[model samples]
Target chain A: MLTGWGRTSPTAATLCAVHDEADVVDAVGAATPERGILARGLGRSYGDSAQDAGGIVLDMTTMSGFTRDGSTLRAQAGASLDDVLRAIVPEGYFVPVTPGTRFVTVGGATAADIHGKNHHVEGSFGAHVRRMRVVTGTGEVVECAPGSDAFAATVGGMGLTGVITEAQVDLLPIATSRMRVDTERHADLDALMAAMTQGDHQYRYSVAWVDSLSPAGRGVLTRGDHASLADLPAGTDDPLAYDPRPRLGAPPWMPSGALNRASTRAFNEAWFRRAPRERRGEITSIPAFFHPLDGVRHWNRVYGPRGFLQYQFVVPDDASALVGLALQRLREAGAPSFLTVLKRFGPGHDAPLSFPMQGWTLAADIPARIPALRDVLDALDGEVIAAGGRHYLAKDSRMSAQTLSAGYPQLARWRAMRDALDPRGVFASDQARRLGLTLGSAP
Target chain B: MINAVGQAQSVLVLGGGSEIAGAILRALPAARLQRVVLAGRRSSVMEERAAELRGRGIADVETVDFDARDTASHGAIIDAAFDAGDIDIVLLAFGVLGDQEALESDPAAAVDLVTANYVGAVSVGLHVARRLRQQGHGRLVVLSSVAGDRARRANYIYGSSKAGLDAFAQGLGDALAGSGASVLVVRPGFVRTTMTQGMSEAPFATDADAVAAIVVAALAKGRETVYAPAVLRPVMAAIKALPRGVFRRLPG
Candidate 1:
């Protein structure tokens, strides 16, 4: 049984670990229309994007390696950002873009077209990729680069076009593996949005943690940039030394309601109160500043057996008020959200299915078992779509096909291009089947 | 594909005319369901049922002729349903509810009822299980009556047949444990349907929709077995624990 990060809607798939390009070709070649094939990375997508029921799932993590030539790194698609960072950080380089977690593989990152806190300044991960080698549904290897139709479809195509085997990515140079951070607390959603809209341009990275349970949507905003050697203490040793290890592992089991309203509300309250009202230029480790939750292994388990759903949507700057309205709806529905994040996105790239746009994006984690959560989200989906926004497919586990079509107007063009590349409809995932991304019969 | 939210896209009903199965199909989200396959003996009722599902907004609706007593044809019937596509749910809703007095007086009629309920279910159940196992994921919902819990004197012939079916379904569920395919045995109390139209209302009698709602909820929770009108669970326990002499003395 395989499920995505959300641990929901698990389905059985014949897992085939591909060690090289040949194995990927063999796997794709063996796929039939009845049970199609899908390429799986580290399975970081929160929904069913990585799984295919009664089909072949090519596990691409076994083929992993990378080589750097100056600022450009030619890396295997299966190489994770975590592994990439470990190898390149000491050499004064970092991935151009990373999502909330570093466990995602290059192939998964490109397929999802993930964006990071630096999105307002830099585009999504696809923008940083110079070129890629993909094994199409017909078992043919093709090289695609920027401005190519293949590249546009392959990136954020949700692996429907083909299996990405390798990518040439432009790396970001870093002086040290530390971040120069600035922190501030906002009393309400308006303040946070104003501060982000006005001052986000000055920082390389920015994100806000909002208290969904709070009536005012209180939040803590953090912004940072790579720390130069002069910014670090003179006595610091091995400034580029980078090693991130999980400090704690969640217990084997947690009760279904362990993260209920009472517990999460208190946790959110304490977390909000702990942040400084305003603190500037505090030196911090890259892992600490970027992925604090990564320090806790299997942190998602804390949500319990029913798992959780991450509802993330991007609305244009003109419709940013929907963010506050969503929070208010969640609060009114009595749904307890453990984590809520707000970010600003720069202009989206050429990838038709890519999620990012010049807009305001908000993501929240709510327990899947909550009775009121589905209706609340459905209502939010209508408003979000009406506001000219779309949901992040990487984080979605339950959005409908109508919502997908309404959110992504380019779906028809993407489908046409995808069908051209794979006429047999060999590449399929549960998410693809659920959202009608492919023309094949629903599985 | 059944999504994380428990919305199934495809369903195959083994008994097209079964009221309980129709209720369950209607209770599901019609807009999300892409296909509905009703397998039963050919008749206008089957076509009308298909038309009804299509009218409800289900895009694809098809029917195949299926005879419960034709054990030799069971494999083909199951293959026909699966060959169309991967079925997310299979409703095993075919059975005979013979009149107790007439069945008891005529041994041949009693044997026929047993053949239809027990023997026929075994044939189709095994065939469906094989397909589900090969597919690696699907739910087979077996509609077992609460009478199967114990064979009372009033309707022992029909009750015993259902008892055999319930046991077969339970064992089948165990066999599919780690195969990612499993069975859900739904034991509903006296449900007011065409089959039970003329009978006097049994205590705690429920409607087909109520049983359907319970089954849907149980399937969502991944339950192996459930009693419709859930109160029947405790009530059945008391009935099963009664002394044999007292149980036989109780009115039908």
Candidate 2:
């Protein structure tokens, strides 16, 4: 049985770990239409996007290997960002974009087109890729560059276009691993939005943690940029040293209702109260600023066996009000969400299926056991569609096919390109079937 | 495939006219169901069941002829259903509950009942298992009865037939262990359906909808065996352990 990070919708697949490009070619060659094939990385995708039911799941983790050439890092698809960071950070380089966690593989990051806190200043992960080697469904290895249609289709195509074996990505040169941070607490959604809009350009990275359960939608805004060596304390030794490991591990099992309304409310309240009202120029490690959640291993288990759904949607800048409306609706519906993050995306890339747009995106984690969750999310889907927004396919497990078509207008075009790349339709996944991504003719 | 919330997109009911099978289909999340195939003997009852599913928002409702007594045709009937689409759930609910006293004297009727209830099931069960294994993922729900737990004097003929079926299903489940296909043997007590309408209510008697609810929950949890109303598991155990002499003396 295989499941995404959400641990929901588990399906059985024939797992074949491919250690090289030849193994990938052989695996793709053996795929049958009755039960197609899909590529799986670190399994960090929150939903079924990484899983194929009754099909061949090519586990690419074993193929992890990379080489550094100046500021360009060429990594195999299976090499995780954690591995990339450890290798590059000490050498004064960092990934151009990273999501909330460093456990994501290079292929997953590119396929999902993950965005980071710096999305307002930088673009998604796909924008940094110079070239990639992909094994098409026909068992042919093709190298695609940025301007090629295959490159656009392969990036954020959810691995449907083909199996990406390796990628050459441009890296960000950094002076030190430490980050110069600024923090502030906003009274309500309006204040938070206003503050972010007015001052986000000054920092390379920006993000806000919202209290969805709070009526005012109060939140904490944090912004930072890579600190220079001179900014470190006078006696600091090995300023570029980077070592990140899980400081703690979540319990193996937790009761289903452990994150109920009352407990989450109290936790959110305490979390809000603990933040300093206004702080600036605070020194923090790279892990502390970007991937704090990674400090605890298997933290998703905190929601217990029922698991949780991370609903993330991005509306155009003009439809920013939908972000506040979503939070208010969840609160009114009595849906308890523990972690809610709000970020601003600069501009989307050429990838048709890429999720990021020049807009505001909010992500909230809601327990699946909540009775009102389905209705609330469905209603939110309607509102998001009306506001010209789309949910992130990487984090989606329950959205409908109609919603996906309405949100991504280029879906038809992407399908056409994908069909040309894999006419036999060997690349398939549970999400592809759920959202009708690999169904029907392109037109 | 079953979705994250445990809703199946398509279901195939071998015994389409069986009230328990209809109830199970109705009990599923209607909004999530795209297709429902009813395979049973051609009759207005099967058509009515198909109409009911269409009314419940299932866009595709198909009915195909299936004859339990004609074991030779089981493979063709099952193949047609699977060929239509990937069936997420297949319900094997066909069986005969014959009158024991009448069957004892009528040799032909006894043989017919055994062939329909046991022999026909084995044939259809194996066919469905093979397809499910080839497809790599699907759940086959076999509706056995509490009578199968042990043979009693009152309905030993029917009980003995179900006993054979129950064992066959259990063995089939073991064979498909790692094949991504599974068998859910549901041992329901007397259910208030057309088949048992006029009969006296047995201990732990349940309605078809109640049996359906139990079966649906068991499917979600991926359990190998389930007893409708749940209490029948312990009751059947005690009844099986009862001394044969004492059991024969108990009031029917």
Clash count, one per candidate = 1, 0
What is the Å distance of residue B102 in model 2 from its true position? Answer: 1.6
Per-residue CA lDDT of model 1 for B32-93, tens digit only, reads 68899999988788899999988888888999888888999999888988887778899999
| Model 1: residue B204 alpha-carbon error in angstroms | 3.4
Q: Identify the runs in model 1 with alpha carbons over 4 angstroms from their true place.
A: A440-443, B42-52, B241-246
Pairs that clash in candidate 1: A443-B1
Please report, as a residue range, the 10-residue window in candidate 1 chain A with the lowest summed lDDT: A434-443
* CAPRI rating of model 1: medium
For model 2, how does the per-residue alpha-carbon lDDT over A287-327 read when each residue is reduced to its tens digit?
Answer: 99999999999999988887777999999989989999999
Interface RMSD of each: 1.8, 2.3
lDDT of 1 by residue, A1-443 (tens): 88888887777889998899999988888888776899999988998999887789888999888899999999888999999999999999999998889999999999999999999999999999999999987899999999988999999998999999999999999999999999999999899999999999999999999999999989999999999999999999998999999899999799889998999889999999899999999999988988888898898898888787899999999999999999999889887886899999999987899999999999998877775666678889999999999999999998889999999998888888888788788898888877877854222
- Residue clash pairs of candidate 2: none
Scored on chain A only, each candidate's TM-score is 0.98, 0.99
